[model samples]
Target: MKPTGTLPLRAGLGLKPEHYQNALDAAEKAAGGGLWFEVHPENYMIDGGPRLAWLDAIAERYPLSLHGVGLSLGGPEKPDEAHLARLKKLVDRYNPASVSEHVAWSRLGSTYFADLLPPPPTRQTLQTLGDHIARTQDYLGRQILVENPALYLSLQGDISMVQLYVEAAQMAGAGLLFDLNNIYVCAHNVGGSTQDWLEAVPADQVGEIHLAGYTAQDREGDEVLIDSHGAPISGAVWALYESFITDAGPKPTLIERDENIPPFDELMKEAGQANTIMDSVARDRQYG
Candidate 1:
């Protein structure tokens, strides 16, 4: 297998099926620099199909990141062997700049859940997750990034979630995919400081950053923010993202919108906004 390389420090868009043609055109015009795209590997895990063909055509033009949603690394059992094999195939085929999976679990025995459920951040759970991540890296022959999940309900984890992620990455020799929207949603829902969590992240270990839209609703006589990548990014999330970029420097950032898909131009506009922030930060660092 080819060695995984670092993604360019620029803005990327989540590659949705609807935007395939536009992504390809943009990539071609960009000549494979200054932009990148990420996709859920599960969507293209097929024997033979037009989807894979579309990915092939696009991969030829732009750098790609394989963001896995079904690894279930934090589950009680080991990472599913079959699922890992499928992921390995995709990784080998694409040789993405990065490969990432959620720090949350979504599988129990043979049954799979649609949602990426948060794992209890206990010491024992941490060790299990670390072991699983190590095994996954060994299997793929490359380090994989673990992403923070959006939590809805509280759990009885002994350690703070940030500490859990830090320790997990250190234990497994992996990197982090910092989803800023998730942090905002989690902090608002659970009552904590988003900036504190952002400050706690080890800058050197962050491989990528994600920005997306979220929704707020009243539930049980209180308001909660849901990490729904359906609408445009909120102003508060944008502020948090700018703060993070200014502190951590620029990482390969992504604009994720999985639901309520908009026109390709609109998605690019959001990606462009991210690029503007990144460029402004870079300029400040360069001049100062």
Candidate 2:
């Protein structure tokens, strides 16, 4: 039972508990509110709670995208069946517009790192990831998007990351949630051109896009970019996004701010900026 279909790519926000009602109200008012939201499924994996109730209320009106932080799909072994079961339950209950997880794995042995960690691009790892994605899609009875993770260090691997992602997408019948910021961060940390990576990845497989802020730090007299998701989307990443969207066409873009969240109005302002860019590009295409 593959997911019935993907939600239309439109501007959206990450549904935060503190701003749930605000989102609902904005939706009701038909204000500058975004058309949908992406949430970390792990947050709502609970048996029951007011959180679920709030999500239900807003979801009834606006579309939803379930973004999972765990699952460890890139692990050396199969994905966590229990986690997949919980995700499937969420999909069943909410009938969300889309579901996605990161390309990085988080668990090893019995311990969880609580962060999206990287894996080498080895043939073994690619096969393992492809299998995991296939199993996840089968269990959920729907398609899912695998988001690219920000790289922090260089590792010797079996295959190119783009090839691994493409193969995984093909085998799993999954989509790609192309995160512009992640690519920029990875390119900054490692030595690769963001444009080249963009061209290598299968654009048609990208069903959604994510934009977020990052932090710049220096280590060993070298610069490193961290996917903090804490600040505003940077100009360089915005340029990259513009180039990609110009030809890839607009996909549902999200403004992600997980930490140091400013007021709702401030975030909305950022979303508005993205929406404006998308609209301008779309209008140009229609008229030109």
Each candidate's root-mean-square deviation in Å? 1.6, 1.5
What is the lDDT, from 0 to 100, of the residue 127 in candidate 2?
80
Task: Give TM-scores for every candidate, taking all chains together and pairing residue i with residue i.
Answer: 0.96, 0.96
- What is the RMSD, in Å, between candidate 1 and the native fold over all Cα? 1.6
Which ranges of candidate 1 are over 4 A from the true structure?
A: 1-5, 31-33
For model 2, residues 222-286, the per-residue Cα lDDT tens digits are 88888999998899988988888888777888889999888777778877877778887898899
Q: Candidate 2: worst 10 consecutive residues by lDDT?
A: 1-10
> How high is the CA lDDT of each candidate model?
0.88, 0.84
Candidate whose TM-score is highest: 1
